[model samples]
Target: MLSRISKKNLLVAAGVFVVGSLIGVGLFTFVYAKGISYLGNDPATCANCHVMEGHYDAWLAGSHANVATCNDCHAPHDNIVSKYYVKADNGFWHGLKFTTGQYPENIEIRDSNRAVTNEACLYCHSEFTSDMRMTAGSDQISCTRCHSDVGHRKR
Candidate 1:
């Protein structure tokens, strides 16, 4: 019902609108996630999501308050690259889960994350755990197994 030129123009306009909308959404999400701040090692960034409020509150009152930050325990601290990579991987998965409403009301660490945390625990408490490690023999022991609520006290 219209000339070829008019139809072409309409298609181009629609394409532009779609592209623009996607860009806008991307920019908004980046800002909302506090993307810039996430690049740093600040523990406060973890509290940005409402779901983390209770954990953050408990952490503040927990024994680790003066000694450790969120990243120190939850992320790799061996090197800068590994640290940021883990953070990026975690941030991506977290964003996906949260956006899709697929996350559990009571958040849990994945097994991979648990390994990281265990490594961190050992890294920090190697001196104190020397006897435990020797006594455990072939059996594996995770610090969190006995002290699950140490870092973030139960609410």
Candidate 2:
């Protein structure tokens, strides 16, 4: 059997190695994913993953390119906290889906995300849609019902 001191030293060494390895992996992942870019409002940051490339490209060529951006339509615009929360939430889900290779070939918006997008549309086009929305039985109208691919047309 090893001496007590030797066993203690071995345990310490193993602990140190495990901690160092974890830190190294975390650092590498952050750098590889351009983690810093995701903290900003830049639309291109969304394209960090290959899965988002088509959406990014479509937005670039879409009519809203000059007027809006990915975050504007995809994230909550109410405040900084809400915006980043949506970003982080979306990033986590997207990462999980992409990493697991479980995402559908044709990506579809979740109802929750669609709600955010609808809110964004109403925010920007309230002037044009207010009268219509206020009309009888118009509360059920959804901006995306007819404008589903307005921001990013699927290839």
Candidate 3:
């Protein structure tokens, strides 16, 4: 019961198992214990799949494109240290989800991070003295109540 081919196959299988296991364990520990936000640091992170191209394109086209980035606006910048942490954690989670195939692989991608996005939007738009809250009159326009769909759709 000695076959060189069989032995070689066993070794290959073992190697693959080790690699896969390491990846899984690493993601689980990092995400579950720490948080998700280190993966988006790399520009290529979102480009791994083809669907992100649309959002990326829209950003560049918009007026806020040059002034901000995907994170600059989506994430909270209350403090310098906190801002960094959020970005890192968000990136990590994204990487974990995508690598483990937890993401909706075939579905169209949208603004999934609503909390962060809403805060960011308010941060910038709050400064503008415009009619955001639309009530009975044109002057009474609250952005959050009406056009709250800016991030993750107004719930």
Off by over 4 Å in 2: 134-139
TM-score of each: 0.81, 0.86, 0.49
Q: lDDT per residue, candidate 1, 1-155, as tens digits?
A: 98999999999999999999999999999998888888887778888877788999899999998999999898886898988888999999988898799998889889889888988888889798766653276757777888899899765
Q: lDDT by residue for model 2 over 1-155, one digit each (tens)?
A: 99999999999999999999999998998898898999887999988889889989999999899999888898887898998888889889988898799999888888889889988998888898777553236455567788877998867
lDDT of each: 0.87, 0.87, 0.58
Ranking by TM-score: 2, 1, 3
Clashing pairs in 1: none
lDDT by residue for model 3 (1-155), tens: 75999999999999999999999998887766444333344433344445456555555555555566666665676886777777667567665676577776443423445556555666777766344433565443334445443433311
Off by over 4 Å in 1: 1-20, 134-139
Score candidate 1 by TM-score against the native. Answer: 0.81
lDDT of 2: 0.87
Better of 1 and 3 by TM-score: 1
* C-alpha lDDT of residue 111 in model 2: 86
For model 3, the stretches where C-alpha displacement exceeds 4 angstroms are 1-51, 105-112, 129-155
